[model samples]
Target: MQDKKLSELAATIADPARHDPGDAPISISAGLADWMLAQKLSLAFTSYQTGQLIVAGVGPDLRLSFNQQQYARATGLCYDRGRLIVASMFQIWRLENMLRPGHYANNAFDMALVPRTAHTVGYLDTHELSVDTAGQIIFVNSRYSCLATIDDVHSFRPVWQPKFISALAPEDRCHLNGLAMDGGRPRFVTLAGISDEKDGWRAIRQRGGAVIDVASDEVVVSGLTMPHSPRVHDGALWLLDSGRGQIVRVDPANGKQDDVAFCPGFLRGLAFHGNWAIVTVSLAREDKFRELAIQEGLEERGLAAKCGVLIIDTRTGNVDHSILLGGKFTEMFDVALLPGVRNPMTIGPATVDMIGAVTIGNPAP
Candidate 1:
């Protein structure tokens, strides 16, 4: 993608309504808070359609609490080492959790994330962020059709590219969108197609998707429909077959796929907490997936695409809880599990509250 086109796309999504809480009303399941508390996990997700990063958890009062911070076209999200990494349109942001264990804010918040760093990557169409064991931020550089990391003197440093891709360019040939880590290293990835020409993935959006083993440089599974978020948990390789609205687990050895759960909306973001898989669902945009096979599957099942997070039990393939969004926030991009946090809050650059917030390190300890 050209820089001019990227700038224009960014400008088009700059909506002020994303900063207003009232513009997006959320309706969560009755037992959602209890389910989160039982799992001892807090949820964080990015809504690119609304340009907001949302965090949700249960407060000490046993009620569901949520906080929203605006980031332009927020898409990929990663939480590790008490820091939250978010990928926006033109930059990757790192927000540090400022609260210590057992520390509380206003006697409620246990986690307070404040923006600490921002790396401007010049809109490489970043997606599916992860922190490797070496503390490097690895992300899918979709535009270049490669895996990349932050560079001090350049837009981004290419770490690995598919063998079929001959060169690093902004062609977006295959639409690579998901990355999975094994033993803290890049293990597998999912892409819409295996083409090496500009925008070639669009031709096979229905059944040309595949999952590639990064180490072997081989396509392990194929014939998927817009698969995203290849996650490995409990000795299983799981991914969201987005075009079919199904979560399928694949055997890395033989490339066997098993249907785990069927969701109502277009699935994207995926995270695992214990035996539950937290998946993000988005209402399909007419311009994007109007005639996709997933749309036909929804209609056949008499289901409507919804925008929310579905908590699915991997053991039984059942949706145990959900957090539904209405009004302006109709789509989401990624979800992360924030462990050891009861109630979380964040400060955005647009808010006055961020300016007044200050923290001092121990002096000359």
Candidate 2:
């Protein structure tokens, strides 16, 4: 079937109107398509602002091929093996790549993700999810200020939480928001503050963030400015100091932080590809950080916040490339790299026809 016909069929089976692409204007940096081709990777990101999941890759003609699908309050994204996991408003979705190695769709497309499963976990305010060493899904449960996983019997299973939080409640006491994994286990996390009271993190949003060692239950790094997205890479602990719009590398042993890169906007999602670090930035929400340190940082640097992705060279702490978004989308939550995939597309649950169009099974020898 033709692509247009397939899309129309899918829409007919599902909610056709919900899948309409909005009028947002997206601009890719010069040579970004070529860069993606040379790097052998595609990009996936979530925009909670617009409730969308977006993928960008290089096509066979060396041009950018971008796709967007609607998912309610899409936030955290994870790409493991051939599966893509995404956290939305009240559910977790698992999407599997259906294309076999070296296979193509219509002799042109290379990656096709099909939504296969969804687990309703209520509204836990999920963020920064990853599959652990034991192949379990773990995510930052922001609503309850803890790290949690899907539970068959309950809404969620708490794996870990900040020591300062006395109990698990939907109050968002300290705004615990980032999780870092090591050896397939939750190791570190970032929070907006140390308060144990409801919405207390707001009082210290300017300079009270901290990175805590989960196992030791100790604050490894403190006095940060609304830190988020703690990640372990290249033998160092990296985090985004969102209130300062800077990427910081921390010495795990000594608790020292080195400025890796200063980006424009409020940084959130973080990932590493080879020598490059990928970080997502959003136009700072005035109500959220208007009077916070992030606003001051922007003024000091004579820069305005942006909504997009920055590809920074880790070694030199410089932004090598960027993809900028304008129009309807403003805030982004997470980003994941799709290695070795090109011209990627997804068949969402909203597209019933596309959902039944592909399948996989083992063949008899």
Candidate 3:
């Protein structure tokens, strides 16, 4: 059923005629592959069932390594002050370069800032993390209304919080999905599936989803379907509008959007290596990844989807290389170039983290 339909889509979608630019032997030549492997880091999980993050080198062999301890479904990761910050709804874990195998420190910080008085000012569905030159982390969410921040990862200090619209009495469900830093300043942010500012629900009256510059608390693009995962690449604000199944770029000046690439199904997780974008796609059609298993002829063989990492050429809208993943895995929230690894790293299964409203150093009134 669902799986069969997915396969049909894949059959039509996959263009085998598309080949890698340089078929350099997987193990041969010193180029991007060599650099990726030479500096590869293994952010893998100890237990496959509950692995936190896995690090691997390039080459089909995919050699793996780990730092022990499950960070509980790490959704987004960012390199800050020479450390890898892992984002999760339940907790924000920082893997310092000096972290040992079993070292653990609780209460990174606590504060009286979170309004609920019920839960930590953490994310309900944290998706992305961005750090400013000042070392502050800006995080986003899937359902929570406010974009939150931790001035110090070790302390619970709320620098910026989403201003709730009291008139609307919103449900706190409008999700903030991705974050992109504008001009090295934390104030500008791009959003996906923006909920209604009033009710924290999708305001059908407003444009679907959009790119927002939190500094001004203004929507950058209106009428988007379900855009997700954004980053600044090659001097432009590149974004993924998952709803229209297109990769788009927005003009920082006017917020006009133009399609750069289009893929079927839902696409999430985007990172860049030079000019190539490493992306993760979830083959499932209807929210749950399991639905992909029932798509049609897919039920029997099950799909080891070609939906892993896609190395995309932004200028030409061409996919350079694709790292496929096993279908047994559901969805990948975010993917990044392994700090030290050559291939790339993807944190799988949907996950979340605490976010701070974009910090506009000096926003126009």
Residue 125, model 2: Cα distance from true site in angstroms: 0.7
Report how far residue 249 has shifted in candidate 3, in Å: 1.0
In model 1, what are the clashing residue pairs, if there are any? Answer: none
lDDT of 1 by residue, 1-365 (tens): 77798666756556566344465678888888887887788999988877889999888789999989888889999999889999998899999877766788878899999998899998788999899999999999999999999999899999888898988988999999999989999999999999999999999877899999999898888999999999999888999999988999987667788999889888999999888899999987865656677777777889888899999998898988999999877788999999878789999967898898788766895
* Per-residue lDDT of 297 in model 1: 77
Residue range 1-365, candidate 3, lDDT tens digits: 14574454344325322221122211222243544555443222111112235444443454321122234445776654445666653556655432223332221211111111112334345567777776666666444445556633442343343443322222444556777776666554445445445334445312456666667777667666566777777767777766555688878777777888755445677777666666766565445434221233233445333344566777798766554444244355666554543332332222231233112334678
Clashing pairs in 2: none
Residues 1-365 of candidate 2: C-alpha lDDT, one tens digit per residue = 24674454445336634533377777778988888888889999988867789898887788888788878778899899888999987789999878878888767779888888898897777888999988899999998999999988788999998878899998888988888888988989999999999899989877899999999999999999889999999899999999888899998878888988888888899999988999999986657667767777777889888898899998998888898888877888899999878778887677675647666678878
* CA lDDT scores, all candidates in order: 0.89, 0.85, 0.50
Error of 1 at 70 (Å): 0.5
**Highest-lDDT candidate:** 1
TM-score of each: 0.96, 0.91, 0.63
- List candidate 3 stretches off by more than 4 Å: 1-51, 58-69, 99-123, 141-143, 151-164, 167-171, 192-207, 285-306, 339-365
Highest TM-score against the true fold, candidate:
1
lDDT of 3 at 102: 39
Runs with alpha carbons beyond 4 Å of true place in candidate 2? 1-21, 352-355, 363-365
Winner by lDDT between candidate 3 and candidate 1: 1
